[model samples]
Target: MDPVLIMADDDSDHKIERRRGPSTSTLSFSGIIAVAGLLASGVATYNAVQNDIASLKRGELYQERTNERLSEELKSVRIEQRETMKEFNEKLDRIIDQWARGRKQ
Candidate 1:
């Protein structure tokens, strides 16, 4: 082989080796951070769901209690109204009887 040609071949073969540079470390670090973030997000979502369920249960219990209280109040009011109506009717009957007696006389 010609000397010049061989030297040219050696130079071409000795070309600078390719390096990963900072990309390798950056990718590894980014991957680890991304995985950690995903885990954290999952945990947060789970907690939020649990909290929502608990809150709903509490609200439901409160609503049931409120409904029961309102129902009791409505029942008492109805009973009072019935008693008042009975008394009014009795008074009206007495007045009507007296009026009828006066008319007859």
Candidate 2:
């Protein structure tokens, strides 16, 4: 097909010319390669994002397990502390009773 051109004339003997606009048939092989490359880049980016999300999920699961273990350890320590305190108080009471008896005699 013959491409159309626009011509403009001014009164002072000056002229302007414009070429026809490009159509889909005018797209070159390089343009097609560029489009394909863009699509591939998008796919690569999406895969990277998915991998990042999976890694974060694994890290979150590990953290949850660690927290549970720490909580159990803390409970055990508290129970042990309570038992130690009870034994100390009993020993103090017995010593006080012995001192009182000695003073009476």
Candidate 3:
């Protein structure tokens, strides 16, 4: 530790004295509290970011599943439409054939 010299006045002559000041190693109460609050805030921010990332992942998964289901449903509807068209065309052809034969007779 460094000491500061102080001068004093006496009856006959002047005298010299030593004094001490605040130490660098020790922190005040308010300083300690401020540091602790900073640490707590940092921890809270980190956790919040982690939670947001997880939520985004879940949302992505849900969207992919919904898209897959929609594709499958569209494929099934196309197949059903194809079958209906085939049946209608066969019945029309049969009717045309019968009309032509009746006209010939």
In order, what lDDT does every prediction score? 0.95, 0.86, 0.85
Q: Show how many residue pairs clash in every candidate, following the order shown.
A: 0, 0, 0
Which model scores highest in TM-score? 1
lDDT of 3 by residue, 3-38 (tens): 332322223375446686655545576678899999
Native RMSD of candidate 2 (Å): 7.5
Q: Rank the candidates by TM-score, best first.
A: 1, 2, 3
The TM-scores, one per candidate, come to 0.75, 0.67, 0.62
Distance (Å) between predicted and true CA of 23, model 1?
5.7
**lDDT accuracy of residue 76 in candidate 1:** 100
lDDT of 3: 0.85
Clashing pairs in 1: none
Q: What stretches of model 1 exceed 4 Å from their correct place?
A: 1-26
Q: Tell me the tens digit of each residue's lDDT in model 1 across 1-105.
A: 899878978887567668656787898999999999999999999999999999999999999999999999999999999999999999999999999999999
Give the true-structure RMSD of model 1.
6.5
What's the best-to-worst order under lDDT?
1, 2, 3
Number of the top candidate by lDDT?
Answer: 1
Runs with alpha carbons beyond 4 Å of true place in candidate 2: 1-26
On a 0 to 1 TM-score scale, where does candidate 3 land against the true structure?
0.62
